[model samples]
Target: MIDIKNLHKSYHMGKNSLHVLKGINFSVSEGEMVSIMGSSGSGKSTLLNILGILDEADEGTYTLDGTLIKNLNEKVAARYRNQFLGFIFQSFNLINYKSALDNVSMPLYYQGVKRNVRTEKAMHYLEKVGLADWASHLPNELSGGQKQRVAIARALASDPKLLLADEPTGALDTKTSYEVMELIQGINDEGKTILIVTHEDDIAHMTKRIVNLKDGLIIDDSKVTQVRAKAENYV
Candidate 1:
């Protein structure tokens, strides 16, 4: 679903230039779950930003879901992002004042879905993430795991082709992280392509493939027997 080759990215700070991604290359097929692992200052975040079309690369090619991605104006980029990509962030970026159901339905509202249809779809996804009963609660009233579940439901409400999660379990305890990964695994099993950017080794292991990055390049890319995260086992 994603094909990137010779991608290069750099940032200019006054007269100094810092190269973030150096000729990165990778492809992810539909129904595959992959993790990008790296330490601080690695190019994982740069690569992900490029993949999400949040930032443009300095050079090279990125083809997502078969369309070449480059030089998109902000409006076009926003359109593609809404149509094809779903994002989950470390911060669980939910509206603080909105109820869980309203948060989940916000994306659909932006997409111009009718109010009733959007609410129905949002509730369905909230139920999928085991948060149906919590739909009326605000983010402040929910636990970290509950908030993240609502965020995941928000991401899924649009039925995008790819899901990009940046440190999805970063804020939670170990048991909660495991529960979240278990939910993510079930999503992948249903044929959704996912890419997780995480520094945690255990988190990377939960994915079917791990791609190691260092000094702006991919050092290792290999498939492994997936480690299933069972909430019960963690508890």
Candidate 2:
């Protein structure tokens, strides 16, 4: 579902340039669940940004689904992002004042979905994430895990082809993290292509494949035996 070749990115400060991604190459197939792992300065975040079309690569190419992603204007980029990608951030990124239902429906609203239809879809996804009863609660009113669940619901409300999660379990406790991973695993089992960026080894092990990055290049890309998160124990 994602293709990248010779991907390179750099940030310039004064006379020096910091190259974050250097000659990166990888492909993620439909229905695959993958994690990008790296330490600080590894350029994994930069890679994720490029894949999300939030930023452009200085050199190389990225193709999402079937369309080439390069130098698009904001309007076109936004259209592709809405139609082809979904995002889950560690921060949740939900509006403080909006209820969970409203937060989940925000993307659909941006896509011009009718109010009733979007509401129905939002409820469906909230239910999928086991947050149906918390729909009326605002972000501030929910627990950390619940807020992330709302974010996941918002991302899925679009039914996008790919899901990009950045440090999805970063802020939660171990049990909560497993709970969230369990939810994510179920999502992947249903055939949603997922790419996660995480520094935690245990978290990466939950995914079907891990791509290790260092100094702006992929050092290792291998499929591993998936370790299912035992959220049931925590519950």
Location of the lowest summed lDDT over 10 successive residues in candidate 2: 226-235
lDDT of 2 by residue, 168-191 (tens): 999999999999999999999999
Quantify all predictions' global Cα lDDT against the true fold.
Answer: 0.94, 0.96
True lDDT of residue 217, candidate 1: 95
Deviation (Å) of 215 in candidate 1: 0.5
How close is every model to the real structure, measured as TM-score? Answer: 0.99, 0.98
Query: Which regions in candidate 1 have their CA more than 4 angstroms from the true location?
Result: none
Screening candidate 1 with a backbone cut-off below 3 angstroms (N, C-alpha, C), the clashing residue pairs are: none
**Angstrom error at residue 32, model 2:** 0.3
Tell me the alpha-carbon RMSD of every candidate. 0.7, 0.8
